[model samples]
Target: MRTSANPIIADLRDRIQHLEGSVARHKAILPFGVPEIDAHLPGGGLAYGALHEFAGGGVGTVDGAAAALFAAGIAARTKGKVVWCLARPDLFAPALAQVGLHPDRVIYVEAIREEFVLESFEEALRFGGLGAVVGEVVRLPMKASRRLQLAAEGSGTIGLMIRRWRRPTEVGDFGHPTAAATRWRISVLPSEPLPVPGIGRARWLAELIRVKAGESADFVVGACDVQGRISLSSDTADGSGETRRSVHSG
Candidate 1:
């Protein structure tokens, strides 16, 4: 025998699903799928509706590229458009695609001046229908960070700040307190030796410098697989083992 679903019951189920989705969007955390790393962050993942800062450990191009890849991976996980505000003319589209963030999903903005960068970030964060807003700037004051945080909260978007300074001394400026929910420093690390003679995927010393409700910590982990996934070295997941491994799986 075949029976059709009741219209009233079907309507109620749809309503329930909508409510559940609303709750998740308002209070969900995006997991990075690494238990050891998630243990150091509140809610076991990166919180939405807030600002996160990622900075290179040095002035070298490799350092900045590492940070950018990390930030891009985060954006790739989100569900909508991403606005990338930077002045760099050499952003190889292939490199971004390597981390799972395709060019079609990104809206790149070239802001030559620091002031314009801030403005663009704020604008993107305020606008609706964005997954994230990323900005590359040397200076991010407490006030500017607060604005970004509030805007993201209002729009339910994530904000990423990539700090790259011209002078070595200027790098110190990024260590100061800001309204960002979390801050990270990415440093390039040597990769594990491969069975074949070839350069492996990027490895990094990812330092969680600040978190809203967690202590700072560091981990050497593989980042941004072809699928835009990050994972902790299985040996080091418990915080007691060490092993050199490529950022991407073979």
Candidate 2:
């Protein structure tokens, strides 16, 4: 196997090789750098070159913004430019910058229709040189998600699908199955208390709704900081804060 001086390129090559079945399943994983969250993942991090889904816990704008920022924070840690495909043109680039995904590093592809958004998303995933590809769509069918997953695996690029609905009724589509490796729902929570009398860091209820081979878990975490890192809530450790929950615990 050929190797590049750049570690990022090397990892990308490894992922492509793994997808071709030329090597063992040694795909690179992106750790959130939080042991509490990584402990639940199979590889102690999110697998590269895979499809993951994210959604808001409710139909409110606050929940939706939280979900978008969560995805942006994850993408910020990657190595290359990001391609964002969306049907709506309402994205605020400044808000993404606050989450560490600088607007300069992102390429926005605004399509008039959701179908075009999905098409752009899949094509970007196949391009292979991007840090990540994000698609904001209302519906993602199993077949479409499978194609996205395969494309991501082929190129070693991460694919993030944000399930957003214009109508509250469309939220029900989230219950449908997909080929994503993991599914998450984010809800805005009250910010952590401050030392004085000012606002503190934002808090979120991050729910791992599904994983490929891991149990679902819920955590109350502080919002991503300037470095795109999330800290576990201190109150949770003392049992005074919201209780963490896990489904089918062993």
Which candidate ranks first by TM-score, i.e. highest? Answer: 2
Please give, for residues 11-105, the per-residue lDDT of candidate 1 as tens digits. 89999998667646855587788887887778998887789999997888789889989998988888888999987666777888998899999
Give candidate 2 misplaced runs (Cα > 4 Å): 1-26, 237-243, 248-250
TM-score of each: 0.82, 0.88
lDDT of 1 at 18: 84
Q: Where's the lowest-lDDT run of ten residues in candidate 2?
A: 18-27
Residue-wise C-alpha lDDT for candidate 2, range 168-248, written one tens digit per residue: 999999999999999999998878888899998898888998888887888889998876788788755335665465774
Clashes of each: 1, 0
- lDDT score at residue 37, model 1, on the 0-100 scale: 81
Give the Cα lDDT of each candidate.
0.81, 0.87
Off by over 4 Å in 1: 1-25, 234-250
